[model samples]
Target: MLNKFLDEVCSHIRCKMAHNDIRAELTAHIEEMQSAGKPIDEAIAAMGDCAEIGAKLDKQHKPLIEWPLIGLTAVIVIIGGIMAFTNDYVMNHSGSDFMRFLLFAVLGITAAAFFMFFNYTKLRDFTWIIYGAVWVIFIGSLIMGTRGNVSYVFLNWIFIAIPLLVAFAGFMDKLRGKGMNGLIISTLLALVSLIPAVLTARRAVIFLLVPFFIMLLAAVYKRHFGVNIKSQKAFLYSGLALTGLLVILSVIRNPYRFARMTDFITNVPEGNAWLISALRDAISSANWIGGADIVYSYAPSVAVPNLMADFALANVIITFGWLAGIVLVAAIIALIVRMFMITRKVKHDFGYYISLAACVMLSMQFVISVLMNLGMFPFMGVSLPFVSHGGTGYAANMVLVGLILSVWRRNNIIGKVPRENKNIQPLVEYADGKNNI
Candidate 1:
């Protein structure tokens, strides 16, 4: 009778993903009725007509298409294409760079579409495997690198770092109930992600480590670690202190890094000073709408090598004027703000963690890129998310955006049981009276 009833109810539900949840809920309702001394028939009848109940559930569980996010993404993509095209036209006097930009944008959009439909929950089953794979690849690259291949081995760590960020969130989900042991393990796991930075690019490592920690802190704050409030706070401070100590130690040990850190403060135009000087001058001379006067007077001086990649934001400001740059930065910030807001709406642990991770990572990269261009921060290997011309970086960011949208799409359907009511397990037994049926 139960199986037959469920089949009938599920027949009315169009979303197959909601079927298991519907079954669990309705079965629990019937079990409650039975506990109240009602017979099986009475319990089954207690639920409303199967079709009506299923229809209502279907309505409640339908996927949400967040138009605001879609609109924001469209705006950024269009603006990025314009910025890339115009900058290329000014620089190379041809459309080759614009053509390359279109190719990568298409590739990125395709990746976004694929991950948007991909069931992110499936990543749970292989979370540890994914975690291990990231480390293996990171380590293997260095081990396999010969002097001739050093550039290949170390430079592309961003690809490895992005996966680590995603996988770390899933890993945190797996550690939820383990208490202090889980906290210690997660700290170690996160710290390992930073060690590679000392050996490779610190900027790429910062990209992974900062966002990775943000997710960790968020998880702890949300009580995902099953730790008490006091322990959570302690963990938070301890993590921060450790990070500070590491930074101090690294700066003291590395003269080049220390010098770069102090350059902004000391007003010293030493290493990479020419690029920074040109960027500052371009911004100061740029008109509100048209191109910078500096560019017209002496284009080659301000036309740095990475005008399309690491310094795309600067290029936008110099080529299209400060107003255009401000609008672009504001739009990117608004998008990141929207993503962070969406994290609060996510029901599942994995969804919230992953989305938060991506949001913070994107936010950090965007902030650093802006500051770097403004000469307020040292130049780094960071890119302005979608506006940058690097194919790999753009595609990776699109993947992150796709993952966030995926979580938001299913926000209504994949319901989470509240912590307070978690012990009331639904008796989903199928064995009793099944043989007779």
Candidate 2:
């Protein structure tokens, strides 16, 4: 009995000691016991009851609240507050912009907190309902939504509604087998919602499709490739087919997409010199920390800096400068890499699919944003994540991060299911072949 107890205690100690310091101290005590002429088991027994040690170790390693994501939320909130104040300051001290910012910020924080605390399994089962609701709200917006002269359809309610819907749908999918379906539905809904926007020449809506395209492409890739594609010719063909479709669509809708196809194509100056000059000046001023005040300033009679749709990239470059541009790109790349890592580590199909969806979303956003900035594409007016000053875009991005964090938390809690009723069957199980009748 003593030997058994000592062995259990030693094992507990090994499992709990994550650092070298603890290991060294424990080893020294074991050595001292041996030098005192006690046998190994007897020496271990002399160390006293392990109940206290076991409890201590458990306390040490117990999961605390995730801090990194909390820190990110804090940073976002702070930056958002500053942006709101600046916007208000610029708008003759009217608090309307700040109020809008607060509304979006509060919604985003609430959604994030819910995702962090809710049981993922419950969310997963309701994926379809959430998916359907997004489209319903979107179509309803078309009927009741206010129209803007610049864009065909402007649904303020739907703008807020869709992100909340997507966040919930994403949550459900992340917790269940049909999670990929949620992504697919979300992508389809996003595309469908943009139809009116596109018809009205709302170029801002076009950028929303970038994420949809990426999600669709990833889904096709996974479906065709299965678990491993290296040995499968069918998967290779499927990948080619999907890529071909995307290319065809791009060419049909936006022929300018092919301008960058050939390396020899050159930029046309085409009377845009003044616009380019202004952009350059703005960027130079910002680089020296003196441009924010002037960038938004327009002569009372002159238009508010509306250039060609292709000038969006120039706007970013001019507004933020080269250094900030590089940092933005690096941060986006890091997010993509991290998402991929999480996808790889997840054992559940739901978690894997959700992670992949997020990966596609972030990756596509980065690529399109960079492409637009470089004048390789038209300016679609999509706000850059974490830097742009739009309420809807900021809220949508916050929900995206919340979903990703939820998945990360779920993955970390693997093999650590919350205590449940013993009478309930496991939610999932694998066959062990021992119950043959």
Candidate 3:
């Protein structure tokens, strides 16, 4: 009985060894045959039964892992949280609990809509229609809008209209699985839309100039580094020409912008002494960190009431303190860097354009907000993104974020590189063999 058991154990070991050798030899032979230009089935047939080879190859090539969506989800959630927190602060300062809730609710819905819209993958088809609607809203703002000043319009309609139009257009296109032509067109349309705002706002046109010029720079950058080679020269020249005309017109109307330009050039004492003083006072009033809850009030020293809108950064510094101010600025910088990195990784034109536009929007807000607070640039009522205390500004920024998320999602789906399996032979071997034949 002992001898029989030992013999049986030996037989089992030999069988296992034979099976392992067969697998290794079969795998190597398949690679060799493929490299020598044999068809996959024929190569398998030459080695052994077709059924066995098919089963093994099928198991080897089966997808073992799926792409991670969590990172992208986290980014979207973080942006939404930032927006909500800022909106809550603004609403609380205004002493309107209802508005605070409303703002947060709108922001939450907007974030959800963005996630859903980008996930669908048809954002490229409605480029022209979406583009046209952007223009229509701008024009409509001129006709039916209430005036803030000679050149400023209270066309809050645009804030609502632009997002809805983009969503519908993006949704339609995503269903069709097209490229982001709509996104490209929408960006160009945003440029054209700025024209009417400039024309209507007249002397107040500096508001339009700052955003439009920054956007133009973004477009040029996208064309240069983002692989958009179509009619780039025309777009660049047109933007430059429009900016020049606006600069000339601005000089004629509000000599202050030109004066600031001259002051900047001549190194005049355009120092923001009053603004800086107010900022210092505000900072001293609150804790350096975790004091975003404090809302101190201030009346502008007579020389800078118009600077109220422009001096929001100073206000934030005063109310939140220097450390909070620095943190805010650092956050903006980090966001811009993130955008640049995302754009660089995007291989598709639509994704690249969206990321480029977002970077432009955020960068413009950051530079202008800082300059306005520092009193380097003329006051232009432009609110800082994610930090400013305005419903319209916050909502508009959310829409921009949504569109960016859409582009980013599509880019990941189409352009993600697959991980390599060391067990598998190189795909190029089969192709090289065919070429030789």
Report the number of the highest-lDDT candidate.
Answer: 1
In order of appearance, the predictions have TM-scores of 0.91, 0.56, 0.54
| Cα-based lDDT for every prediction | 0.76, 0.49, 0.48
The TM-score measured for candidate 3 stands at 0.54
Residue pairs in clash, model 2: 123-172, 173-179, 309-379, 313-373
Residue clash pairs of candidate 1: none
Off by over 4 Å in 3: 1-94, 97-102, 105-109, 112-121, 138-192, 202-249, 252-312, 415-437
**lDDT ranking, best first:** 1, 2, 3
Give lDDT tens digits, candidate 2, residues 201-290. 444343445444544445445542233433333433565588579768877777455543332124343244333334444545555232
> In model 2, what is the error at residue 125, expressed in angstroms?
0.9
lDDT (10s digit) by residue, model 3, range 178-242: 22353345455544555654555443234434444454444445443234534544555676797
Candidate 1, poorest ten consecutive residues by summed lDDT: 426-435
In model 2, the runs with Cα more than 4 Å from the true position are: 1-66, 69-99, 135-233, 236-281, 284-286, 292-340, 370-376, 414-437
Error of 3 at 19 (Å): 36
Task: Point out the higher-scoring one by lDDT: 1 or 2.
Answer: 1
